[model samples]
Target: GGLSNLLFKCALPEHILSVGDEPRQVLLRVYGAILQVSASGAGIPPDWQPPPRPAAPEQLQGSGLCRHLPPGPGLAAAPRLLRPQGVDSLVLESVMFAILAERALGPRLYGVFPQGRLEQYIPSRRLRTEDLRDPDISKEIAVKMSRFHGMVMPFNKEPKWLFGTMEWYLKQILELTFPEEEQLKKFNHLKTYNLQEEMKSLRELLESTPSPVVFCHNDVQEGNILLLAGHEASSSDKLMLIDFEYSSYNYRGFDIGNHFCEWVYNYTHDSWPFFKASAENYPSRQQQLHFIRHYLSEDSGRRGDTTHEEQARIEEEMLTEINRFALASHFFWGLWSILQAKISTIKFGYL
Candidate 1:
């Protein structure tokens, strides 16, 4: 049902269920892509084990939740070693963010592994496509997004992660050679677009528009949002955002605008194309303003200090910013879905 990762619900055995402080249940996420190829086989072979996790000195050094938070007592004395040979940089980076997320913002983490980690299994339901348009839910999301944007990460503040990844995806798409006749037929539709030219045009277009850089939860669709058990959508803190696989420092408008585009996508479709996207369902101007207002009001200090004229100017600029960056969101996923069609094992029709 998901791309990139596999999730499993693990329950503690009866004997140990109540013993110690370990969680009774944990969510296991097996990382994607890089974990597929091994020296001995194409995928994870039986009897494989994760390398030992780093400790102490390897503690996360960054912004966001980890900025003021102290290292948990669990991070006690342990041996440290150089980065292992097989582990890629992306996996290591995600592991660091996952650890930081659990400490202050996300669900509590139980264990970390080379491929994935054990996280607290929250009893919740994912928000549906329709839920993203609800005024109350929309306001809450804006507030949370503002909070996320306020923090700075250790990475370069420039929005390189956006165009860099798009460039990589475009390169992969352009290099595909489809040698087999059957493979050529299967992917012939890809010839319709000049992805290289399209990407150049898109990068230039986005570069001309101005937006602030921030640490963004790049994927903020309905499926990634959770409504905790016993809490209704109306509750102030009921919603929680999960999945930081694509999280990075990027343009602020891309984060907000991408979410607006998600209001039309229903990923639960049961047939070909595998999802439904209706452009007519895009948020109205009033709805966008409502969300932007909450986003700006999130920081009480900033909100209280701004004069009415300055607030109006800021709001108008953000409105324009959000609209322009929506194009970036479209260009990004168009390239991303094409690459996913080639590499991903997931059944969804990413193309």
Candidate 2:
């Protein structure tokens, strides 16, 4: 059957189909190409094909009660679908994180497939960069993040991608041979800042202020945060985090720091300078304190009744840690961009 027929069988509404008009084709074009390249690299036969689509859609079992309905006719059921991306290990990690996160605090994972997995399609507005600065929204994000960190799931395998640490990413970047002098010159500009010494300083600070390890949504940028439509501003379930591909156990400060760093870059443009960062965009000291308060309040059970001074002291310490971890975020993504500049076909200023 054709893609349209498949959507009809799933009972998806016509209006829903009109939006994201070419979702399936886009998914196939992007992930399909990546899968083919991955298969070729793995020595798979040239004639190999992607896993066949299931005869029937599978409904998600035991998904928690829906807090708010979609704008159109409420979906009768959320079906699991194939995700045509990544190798076996990567696929497994993605499924594992999705399942664990769903059960805990993130998006609900419906089912797993060989190449792709199924997820509950949430109809919500993707947060704008300005929204991150909103105190109410930022507090909701902090609560959700704190809840995610508190989850204790069992997964023994190490993650294939680790954005919290700088070593692996830096190694990958250093190994790449830039094809043009311009690229080399951009890299040299990065080197002039004495990033190696900065890396050492970051490591020392992290070691000095050791944070408790927890499951982290390593990529908590504005794009990943969704504000549910038709929900009151004060609703606790108003915000939901998506895309767990980079989710893993890491330092708590790194997750918070990475999110703050994300606020500086705008990735909406489709040009050479796809993203621009500015120091003026970083969260101010007062804003950081407000965010940290919400974060620490989630674990109030352990703190017992505390004086205002005690709470203020706690916030001060967390702010210091978050400030230090901000450096690690810069180092991690700086190396990632350098490596992507070499391998990625998509046009963007990775340097």
C-alpha lDDT values of all predictions: 0.67, 0.62
Could you say which candidate leads in TM-score? 1
Candidate 1 segments exceeding 4 Å error:
1-3, 15-17, 37-103, 179-192, 300-304
RMSD of 2: 9.0
* Weakest ten-residue segment in model 1 by summed lDDT: 74-83
RMSD of 1: 10.0
| Candidate 1 per-residue C-alpha lDDT over 161-183 given as tens digits, one digit per residue, 9 for 90 to 100 | 78877765565566664444754
* Cα-based TM-score, every candidate: 0.80, 0.73
Against the true structure, candidate 2 has what lDDT?
A: 0.62
Candidate 2 wrongly placed segments (more than 4 Å): 1-92, 101-104, 156-165, 191-197
Q: Which tens-of-lDDT digit does each residue in 1-351 have in candidate 2?
A: 111112211223334443354232111001223343343323223233334433442432232221222112322211111122225545656666566655755555545555454455555767877889999998988988888888765653343233323554454444455657998888878767876677777678778986667888888987778788889988877988866655777888889999999878877555658667777889999888888888888878755878999988878888888887888788777766665565444456767
Instruction: Identify the candidate with maximal lDDT.
Output: 1
